[model samples]
Target: MIVKTKAIVFSAIKYSEADLIVCCFTQDVGIKTYLLRNILKSKKSNLKTSYFQPLTQLDIVATNKDKGTLEYIREAKVLLPYSSLHTNIVKSSLVLFLAEMLKNCLREEEPNPILYMFLEESLQWLDEHEGVGNFHIYFLLRLSHFIGFYPDASNMKHDYFNILEGNFQETKTSEYCLEGETVENFKHFFNISVDDISSIKLSKTSRANLLELLLTYFKLHVQGYQRPKSLSIINQLFV
Candidate 1:
């Protein structure tokens, strides 16, 4: 069957001399891999391999066998063309880091419209906005809501945030706790929206520490989530 859907490119691996195995998260199908034969063979090819860059949003007409095997796209075009995501160096690095995080964390094989919509809208916002130093921090924080581990911030007045428990506690009882400046910054984000993320500023060191803590929180709650290797590169870029 033919399906028209919107997909976010997660990662593309060169399969052979001229082929690419592209993994994408589709609004209609959660996670799908497509074999794009000869997409990289020539500049004259109808399917420009550039369309498959990390985190690009595309509108595609694809063949869906729905058989748990590799599918193929018959037609594809940019759905939401980014203004500066790929061209701006800082924004590009952010996209790369985000793509790697998504690749590691998004493992579902079924459609999740809510998650898809959140990603689609969020990326568009990232592209349009400036001063995005805090983008990834808030992005991952919001993502936890869909992944089932968004921090419980109802007790926001507490002095300590228990990472393993995913909530604020009156007192720290374990090693997995956020205290002092880190707790202040982390808790500030719990109630923020995407429009307000950039306003929650941090120094380079503070930002790096917060990212580490967020990944630690993820590792504790998510069974298979791995800290993204692109993390250091992103931190270095912002520095």
Candidate 2:
């Protein structure tokens, strides 16, 4: 079936010598990988390699085989042309890290319209904003809502956040729960928006600590998940 959808580019890999394999998270089909043939050999093809950059949203027409094999793109165009995400080093690293995270974490092949919308809005917000040091931290927190295991914030008066159970607790149970300063920062992140992300600052040590805590939280909830390789680079950028 030929289908049209809005897709967020998760990652792209070179196929053979002239083609490319692009994996995208689509609104109508969850996650789909498409084969772009021989655009590297033609300057007039209009589907330049630049379009496959991390988290670049695109309107795509493709063959939806749905047989667990790579589909082919009939047409593609940028849905949002970013002004700063690709050019700014800090923002670009954040994008790369987030993209890698999605590549590993997003495994469904069915449509998730809400998740697609959340990512679309978040990426657009990232592109339009500046000095968004805490953007990825906030994004990961919010993304947990859709990916399952969003922290239960109703009982916020507790002393610790139990990562595996996704709730607050007055007593520490194991290595999975975050206590003290990390819990406080997690609470702060839960209440922030993209507009407020830039203003909410973190010391290098605190930021690094929170990131490790978040990764631990993700590993406990997401099965077969591994830490993103770009995580170290992202942490260094903040320091």
lDDT of 2: 0.88
Instruction: Single out the weakest 10-residue window by summed lDDT for candidate 2.
Output: 192-201
The weakest ten consecutive residues by lDDT in model 1 span 39-48
lDDT of 1 at 79: 89
What's each prediction's TM-score? 0.95, 0.95
lDDT of 1 at 197: 81
Model 1 spans with C-alpha error above 4 angstroms: 42-44
1-239, model 2: which lDDT tens digit per residue?
99999999999999888899999999998899988899778777868889999999999889988898989888889999999999999999999999998988899899999898899899988988877878888998998989988988998899889988999988889876678887888788877667887677689888888888889888888889888999889988986
Runs with alpha carbons beyond 4 Å of true place in candidate 2: 44-46
lDDT, candidate 1, 1-239, per-residue tens: 99899999999999989999999999987899999988887776667888999999999989989898899998899888899999999999999999998988898889999999999989999999998999999999999999899988899999998989999999879888768888888887877788888788789888888888898988888788877888878979765
